[model samples]
Target chain A: MKLSDMQKDKCVRVKSLGVDAHFLNRITSIGITEGTTIRVVRNDRKMPVLVYVRQTLLALNREDCEKIEIEEVA
Target chain B: MNSIALLGQPNSGKSTVFNALTGARQHVGNWPGKTVEKKEGSFTYKGAKYTITDLPGSYGLTGNSDEEKITVDYIKAGHADLVCILVDASQLERSMYMLAEFAGMNVPSVLVLNMMDVAEDKGISVNAGELSRRLGIPVLPFTAADGKGYDRLRDLFETELSSPHLLTSAPNLAEAKSLKEQGEAKYTWITQMLEGVTTTGSLDYKMSRFDRLATAPVLGKFISIGVILLGFIVAMAICMPFMMLGSMFPVLMNEPIANALTAIHIHPWLVSIFSLLIPNTLYFSTAMAAFVLGVNLVFGYLEEKGFIARTAYQFDGVLSKVGLQGKAVAPILMGFGCTIGGTSGTRVMDNWGQKMLAMAIVWAVPCGSIWAVMPVISGMFFPWWGTLLVCVGILAYVFVLMWFVSLVFGKKLSPVETRTGMIMELPPYHKVHWGHIVKEAFYKAGDIFVRAFRTVIVISVIFWVLQYSASGSLEDSLLYKIGTFIEPVTKIFGLGWQSFMTFLSSAFAKEAVLGVLNAIFVGQSSLLDATFHAKTSGVEGMALAQIMSQTIAPAEALALIFACTFNIPCVMALSTTYRESHSLKWTARVAAFYVGSALLLACIVYHIASLFM
Candidate 1:
């Protein structure tokens, strides 16, 4: 599922960053990589969404959030 | 004496450690040719003195930003005898990444695990001895905020020192790893160290309870607005006393002071300068000083307490829509206080183009000087509700103006970079020490006062000279001739010539707008005109707005107020804009654009208000 589509507070493991390489590098440098755990702290339509990854909070726009591929953690 | 620099990410307690060590002996300055601050201080330990530099914090030492570039350059130049790397103990997995980056530099280093108490509270334990063996450096758990473990920290610099070796090439790492896998490889190595040397006492993460309500994606936006509005009101309220004292200057000056000066043998020109120029100057200087200081104190406290990061996080999407980063919210909000301070605040932005574009948009927001005079002007003619309309109207206009300008200049300025997402670690909320806040407010107010005084005084003296001209009494002064001459051109924007003159002078200082209106209206109107009440009446400061409303139609008054608020800000802001951008072409172009747009908006406001009239 796309990261932005995840329900609030649901933990997910990142699959692969489906965004452009430039964005992928940035996300990686910030400690987000494949298999990392992320939780959607908040996601609202018409507003920026908050994601908690690796003990840091990141605010991503809908477009950028859509580019991150993830799977619900069992 | 040897020198060592303290380096860490923001909120990693670098400043705490610096204060713990140097305490009151620090000298602060700016990096050469950059806005980033350079802080250095020295202390003596065991008969040996050492100099300490606090490097600006950054996510990593990349060429992505000025702070990063300065960090790398400072290290490569071999300025530090040893680099004391500070990391948050509770967030080691992520904070240690900087240590991983530092390993490539081959500089001698020591790791100070700051916030050790917090780490213990989180039920985490880091085996410093074993981890030190793996990374080929000494690691010590520390709580810098309390000056705990100072002995161990100093010993690493003093006696336990070893020749630092490259940490990138770990002994147990597989040889197959390539250069590209350096980050992953380091993490893998760190994970191995964690396996043996660390014990996770609990899996239950401790999160701030306040974060839930504050970061609620939808509600958070509204909360952020409320917080900002509350911030504005509190700041204004703090300055209320000074503003009242300043308001009394007009009465105090023209009556007792002016009469006494004339009663003495003081020259009339000197008397005119003192009576006309000095009172307004004192009034504005006091009012402006209070406003800037209050805004910085309030906002700076919030930022220190970590509320600002959540605000940036919550508004990331909204900010991105306007072609700015989430962090840009800080400067834009601060622009309401003082444009110069706001422009300087953008130093944190790594992208030069985005910084420049943000500066452009900030000017469109009416600044604190305008905010000071706004209620004063509107109170007489505008019902309180009408005044609220203008306040809201300014906010609405600024946002729309941002949208329009973003479309026009977005691509050219902030062309998409690789930073699709930001990493914002919101530090735990805490009370700010007011001593530092007051110190900062003092510096900010001092800077604003000097800059405002320089620009306003020069322009005011010129205005005074023109008003008391050799031509004749006030009717034949140079300003009267100029005001009447511009009637045809000023009429296009629905501003009477006198109003036009005040608006023009406002570009030098918005705080002077009320004073100019009082002088010109009192000078020009017939003595019998009861409404032109400033010079001839018992009531002094509040009479300008009433007289203006009575003399001009509401639409024209609205037009004049609209134009004055939206016009190019003060001379201080102009020079500051120029200084920040350092591009004469961009500065002139932006100023020209503001003047043009302000007039267009004024004309539109005038015609719309006229329909109702």
Candidate 2:
């Protein structure tokens, strides 16, 4: 499912990033690669999706999150 | 002396480390032609002197933004004897990406695991020796804020500078030409390097109540406004004392200078300059410096404490309408205090285009002086309700113009790629570091003060000369002749030469517009004469308002108010804009845009008002 579709408190593993090269590189450089675990801290609509990744909190724009594919960690 | 370069991602406490290393010995200037700051300082450690260059922070040496490009180019040029890479020990997994990108650069480096105290609080610990062994470099765990472990760091620095070690276990660089490939390989390498060297306790991730309230869509706006207003009041509290001190300069020095010059048998024009103009210029520059210092101190504290970043996240959706991110909010809010501070504050933006756009939008926000001048001027001609209506109209019009400006200039400044997405790291809230905040405030304010002093001195001297007259006659001065020559064209905007001249002087400084109007419209020869008369009368504000209402027509007064309100803020703002953007062309373009649109706005308002009259 798209990362943007994940609700708050859900843990998901990054399956693939459907973004362009620059964005893909940017996310990867920030430690959000495939198989990385991310917890959705705040996924409120109309707001950037706040997530916990690699001991850091990241705010990703919702539009960009829509392009990111993830799988339920369980 | 050996040289070391500090590199890290944003908010890795690189600045604190730099400040601790080089207390008051640092020199800050622009990097050659770029607006990015270059900070170089020196420190003596155990009788060995070392010069350090604090490179601009970047996510990685990806050459994407100007900061990153400068870092990449600086490193490629082999400028540093040893590169000191700082990473947040609490978040080493994410922060190590820079070291991963630097793996194959073949430069001698030492890894600094900063924020060790924070890491310990999080129940995480790093075996620095093991990590150093794996990375083939010396590693030192440190807490920059507390400033402990510096002795060990100095020893490690000494050892690294004497015998540099290149990374032997760097990530494989084969087939990693593209940024995507490089990022993947780097992250893979970072994971492998951290294996068994770092232990992390399982920490549940949840938004605290405070953060939840701070980022709520509806409530966050009100809360942020309250918080920002409180911040502004605190800034004013800090600023008012300095401003009060500055106001005394004219009173204290003006009479002494006047007596000194007159005793020397100087011409009245020369006497006016030394006595009135010089003191006035000093007073205004001091006011500017004080405001810059206050705004920077308060906002810098907010930024340092991580609240500003939260505000950015909170307002990103709203500001995105104007092709700007949420980070522009602080600077725009600061524009109300002083545009020069706001312009310099635009550095917080991610891209140059956004910085330029943010600065342009800041020009639309009426500054502190404008707020003072607009109400009094509007109140002079119109009744209280009429004045209220005009004030509201001006604000609404400003909002419309800002939207229009973003549409017209946004695409040119910010490209689609730069606007693709926001991937910002929201740092944890930390206590304000007072030492760093004050030093930065003074440093930034001082930089602006010097530039402003240069611009003010030159402009005021020329202004004084043009307005100088041997005989105290308004028409005899060169400025009067120029004003009359331009009167015909300016009349289209419902302004007489006196009002036009007032408009012109407002660009030098906004509050001076009222004084200029009083001088010229009341048939005084020079601004110095108007000031002397006002000082003798002891009732300048009320008397001037009465005289202005009689001297100028309602339409003309309205036009002049709008025109001056929208003029290119001030000479200092222009210089600050140039300093921040470092693009003469864009700066001039924005300035021209304001002047032309300001006149156009005046003309439209005047014609529309005349129709009703």
TM-score of each: 0.76, 0.91
Q: For each candidate, what is the lDDT?
A: 0.69, 0.81
Q: Candidate 2 lDDT, tens digit per residue, B351-396?
A: 5667889999999888887887788878888889988998898888
For residue B20, model 1's alpha carbon misses the true position, in angstroms, by: 8.4
For residues B199-271, what per-residue lDDT tens digits would candidate 1 score against the true structure? 5212234456677778776677677767866776777788789778976876677567768999998987787
DockQ of candidate 1 relative to the true structure: 0.40
- Among all windows of 10 consecutive residues in model 2 chain B, the one with the lowest summed lDDT is B530-539
* DockQ-derived CAPRI band for the predicted complex in model 2: medium
Which prediction has the highest DockQ against the true structure?
A: 2
The local lDDT score (0 to 100) that residue B63 gets in candidate 1 is 32
Interface RMSD in Å per candidate, to 1 decimal?
A: 3.7, 2.1
